[model samples]
Target: MKRRFLVAFLLLFFSYSLNIYAVEEEPSPPPNIGFSLNLLGPIFGIYSLGVSSFLTSRVQLGLNGTYFDTRSVDPKVTGWQTQVRMNYFFSPLYKSGFYIGIFGGFESVQIKNNSGRSDNYTDPIGGIIPGYRWSMTKKLDMLLGVMIGYMYGDIQISPELSFVYLL
Candidate 1:
């Protein structure tokens, strides 16, 4: 009798479990593009702007331009750079999370010596960047990272901070 009761209870439990239902949620669409401005650059006499687009849900393509000048210091330096970068995000969404990227670009710099003579040079630059991005609001976000790269035949590490406005 106990064996018969156990089999009946098991069958009833399986039938009830199979009738249970679950609801699935739909995901929001990924962001298409974003524009970025470097806030820290202005504090150090550099101005920069960038635009980025989503190539897929987890990949992005970006272009940036930057300019800087130091007129008050001896051996004053002035320069500009244009870069192209591709980022692969770790999270499912491309707009926010941790990402690793590679960037390559061309840069030009002019140095003015104490003798008031200016010399200009240009070079190709490339780097690897790893960063974290967080959303501030529905349409605003911030990125913080470091770029380690070769520029002007020297290995340089630069801090990266920017605000992105999504559209």
Candidate 2:
């Protein structure tokens, strides 16, 4: 009798376990706004934040802020910068493959000169930014770019690298 009962219980458990009740749902696509962080800058004590939003398949708007310390540069300088950007993508292979952008912003920097004097300047800045963006995964992306800007009353070039998460 005990053997018979155990066999019956096992059969019933297996029958119920094999039945399907609910189906799993698929994940939704990524959102339009992507928030990013600069990994390269932090190694030298500059912290940066960036955001990009898709206006259309070919157009995107972006903004970036950098708060920097002297650890990054020779002769030791400290400053902050803010930029506003807009990009137009050209490559058809991927909507974000390559982009040309224009950016305008302001930056202030202070440096201590060898004469035991600290000099600071605030400059109006504008730049042409060209970049390439590639999807690392469906929801992740990487952007590599360069900016040529007028800052401190002079022309300057800066490199950019960012990891982004699509919202």
Candidate 3:
């Protein structure tokens, strides 16, 4: 009777311990997607937002839309532009989060005079936007960068500062 009681107690204890271990397993978190709002200075200003997802470990593809406004010292030389861009980022497989990439896309610009006269133009613009992004937490980041390129029959170089929130 003593031997049978001991075996039964041991089995119950082991089963209880296994159950507790199973219940303590943690669930994995969802993958992170990034978004940003950029301010590109006085002569020209742009606001852009995008989402990126990794296809491979080091390679990501993203789509971005930008609303751009530009004005010369003369109000008669004001223009509005819009663009859709596709981007690719290359870094080490494990270090994909910190790196730079080249972006290219289509842009349309409309320039108007306060006199109510308007001119419209469309073109392909490509440039390098070099910047560093640091993850503040799982859902917030700080982005600082600059973009230099050509558009609308002139060369463009703009400095940008932005705060990004990931959802």
| Candidate 1 total steric clashes | 0
**Models, CA RMSD each:** 16.3, 19.9, 20.3
Give one digit per residue, the lDDT tens place, for model 3 in 25-74: 22134235656666444335444666665554434456666665655533
> How high is the lDDT of residue 80 in model 3?
42
TM-score of each: 0.73, 0.71, 0.55
Residue 82 shift from truth in candidate 3, angstroms: 5.6
Better of 2 and 3 by lDDT: 2
Q: Compared with the true structure, what per-residue lDDT tens digits does model 1 show for residues 1-167?
A: 46744663465455435434423232366578899899877766778999998787667799999997867666676899899989766544523456667899998988788998887769999998767777677678787776879864468877788897879
What lDDT tens digits, residue by residue, belong to model 2 across residues 63-139? Answer: 98888786545645689988898876554313345556788988897766556667787987898766677868766
> In model 2, which runs have C-alpha deviations exceeding 4 angstroms?
1-30, 92-96, 113-117
| Model 2 residue 98 CA deviation in Å | 1.9
Q: Candidate 3, clashing residue pairs? A: none
Q: 1 or 2, which is superior by TM-score?
A: 1
Give each model's whole-structure lDDT.
0.75, 0.70, 0.52
Clashes of each: 0, 0, 0
